[model samples]
Target: MPSLQALKRSARYELIRAGLEGTALALNFGLPLTNPQRGVIFALHHVDPESPANWAPNAWLSITPTFLEQAIEVCKEEGLIPIALEDLPERLADPQDTRRYVCFTLDDGYRDNARFAAPVFQRHAVPYTIFITSGFVERTRSIWWKTAQDLVMRTDDVDLSTFGIDTRVNIEQRAERVALFDRLANAVNDAENEDTAIARLDSLAAAHGIDPLAITEHLTMNARELAELAADPLAHFGAHTLTHANLTKVDDKRLETEMVQSAARVGGYVGAKPTTFAYPYGYASAVGAREIAAARQAGFVAAVTTRPGLLSETSGKAATALPRVSLNGFYQRKRYVRALLSGLPFRLRQT
Candidate 1:
């Protein structure tokens, strides 16, 4: 039996799938007034040839390599050119250059990105970027999300009450696991002192026979691996903040260090200064005028957010904090990918 969360996700997926079908039909009919963007940038995460788990709670963070191949084909079929993230700001700046474009960017330097995603992009000759979070590559900070999932799934019951939850949580059933996963995620992200919260989780995982640091080392590509992947002409490397901290709550000095040093570290592997940035958790709250300003001050040519939408002339002006359409795990169909690029799903959201 599926958990309530799974059922909710299924219903939401169906709703968006129906919306995408409408978007595709409308796109075919040519509704330029509503869908005014000439191009889009795609946000992606894990791309692996194998399914990570049978009932993976974090499944949305991943996609199969086959889906990636189809994604490239779909963008080409739509008449959009595949470009690098570094070129986007320049393209966005030119009034005469109205050609539609698609840039692929995967965040946090995952191993699967090099193992599975790189081959497809190389085969298609598409220019793609990997935003490297230095701490993940060096195993200096916790890749808290992956660690949380592994700990909750492996242990039958978890006592996070010591971490400040009032009650001990059961993780035997899938539903129980989902609830605990969410609870733990909230505890960590929503905490006043996030580092303190993360330490508690590391301790919790250790108590339950899980190794948090090992999870980061295992999942992410190291400095040497990144250096090897950078040899591909089709590949570009960009900086994601060192610790993957929410940029908003951090101090100005810390923010600059996170942004600048992260890029410098990525540059060391790629043999050039990385000119792009992707904000950690790039949502409305995490990214704002301050973070955008910091990107420019850090010497980044552009920065991307997790905000959903297509790029237009008005939005392209603020190159530092640009929006991107997610190449979502739930809606991995080629038509859905086309629909996302068509700008119709986001258009429908306005009305």
Candidate 2:
């Protein structure tokens, strides 16, 4: 059975989809009267086409190589030039460069980013950023969300009574599996020690005869692959914390450690300090003035959040707390991509 939260989320997704469709139509017909003049930064995760089949509930996080290609093509068609995040300062400052710009950012340092997404961006000669979670690269932490999904898929059932879930989920049912995954993900997020939370889930999966760590061995880029990616001139590295923990939940010292250590670790691998940072979870709850100040203090040139809005001149003022438009899985159509870049939807929200 779908959890009430899942049901509500689905409803909200549908409503947002409808609004995006309408907004796309309006922009296409020039009904919005004005468009966003600023550049855009798109946030993405897991660009593989195959992984979504195994985890249906989180499919939104993965976009196919084809969709990525289409999205890039749309960006070109709409007269937007691709720029690297590092180039933003100069681009924004230049009075002569009139072309609107877009930057692509993929979080989580997924292996498929190199295997699939890189070639696509390379073909277009576009520069992009990959934010790495140091713990993930070190293989000291498992991606709990992926582990939770794998646990439900591989096991016949899951007992959740200990986690305050009243029922035993029948994993064979897709809806039940999704609900269980959601509950587990929430638990992991709320956990004081996210690594401990993931370890608990791993134990649960082990009891059911699955090794969650083994399952995720290929999910994220290993050290060697990261080194190779960092060698690419078009590719830039950014710190995404050490364990992908929610910054808002950790104490001041731990939060600073996560940010500073991650930058140092990536710097070690890439042979230079990472100039950018991406807050784990990236929402307002996960990041705020406190976290932003910490990132700046840690020496990041800028930090980005998962906030939905177009970039503007004023955006540069809040460099460490910048917003990004997620090219979400729910809206992969090229038209929707154009709509998002149009900035019409964000403009409408403001009024």
Candidate 3:
């Protein structure tokens, strides 16, 4: 028998699909505007289906293989040009050129990236950047979203009161619960210790009477796969962090180690110093002025955060602390493409 939570999730999926379909229809028939002067930088994570199913929900943020191809076509038809991260500093220096642009970036360096997404980029001649977690690539036990999923699905009847997580959701109210799960995922990502976060998941499972390790078996990507992907021309590597820690929670020295070590390790594998960095859980609270400075000191040419905005001529030359619009699962609607390029809104939201 399906659990109430499972049944609710099924219904929520239906609602989400309906909403997306409606949004797509509106984009195709209702909102058609031109912004010849603007471009967007898109963010992606988890490239393959082999990711721990529980830990990495495909619906959380992923493009179907078909959507990936279609998005490329749409960009070309709409007169958008896709550029590499390395070229962004140059292009943003001149956003008035009136050539539509899109810079594609993948974060977290999952092994499935090489297996799934790299070929798509290569065939399309698209240039991309892959930001990696050095600790995981270098053989350290780490917590990733997939591992978190393992904690969720494997554990049943778990309690999370100690972690301040609320798991009381009936099937009819699951949309809200799943949304809360998303926030909890972010909270876990922001936690200082990977172990603590894992434990919290375990506790959540214990509260629900499920096994904690259900998904850990499928969460990791292999080192050989990462090395192979690093050698590709269409792809470049960047630093996410040593252990994927939220830089703001740690002290300066630890932050430095995470940043510098991650860059060094990834650079060694990719045969080039990682020139780009993306703050783990990149946001105002997860990252700050100090963290940006630290990335620069670590020798990254530019850094990106989860802030929603496009780069402009006056945005400054500190590529190490560059801002980016997060292109997650919810941003699939084509209207978002326009929203991302519209600099006026971000600048307005800034104040």
Using lDDT as the measure, the top candidate is 1
RMSD of each: 2.1, 2.2, 5.6
Better of 2 and 3 by lDDT: 2
lDDT of 2: 0.82
lDDT of 1 at 255: 95
Tens-digit per-residue lDDT, 1-351, candidate 2: 778878898887887778789878877777653554667889999897774653366778988888899989988887788988867756765667556788899999999999999999999999999999988888887777788877777777777654455657677777777778888888887778776777778787777777766765768888888899888889998999998888898899999999988899999988888889999989988998899999889877778999888877667667788889887777778888878877777766677
Clash tally, candidates in order = 0, 0, 22
Candidate 2, position 270, lDDT = 86
Order the candidates by lDDT, highest first.
1, 2, 3
TM-score of each: 0.94, 0.93, 0.74
Candidate 2 collision pairs: none
The per-model lDDT (C-alpha) reads: 0.86, 0.82, 0.65
Scored against the true structure, residue 281 in model 2 reaches a CA lDDT of 83
Judged by TM-score relative to the true structure, which candidate is superior, 1 or 3? 1
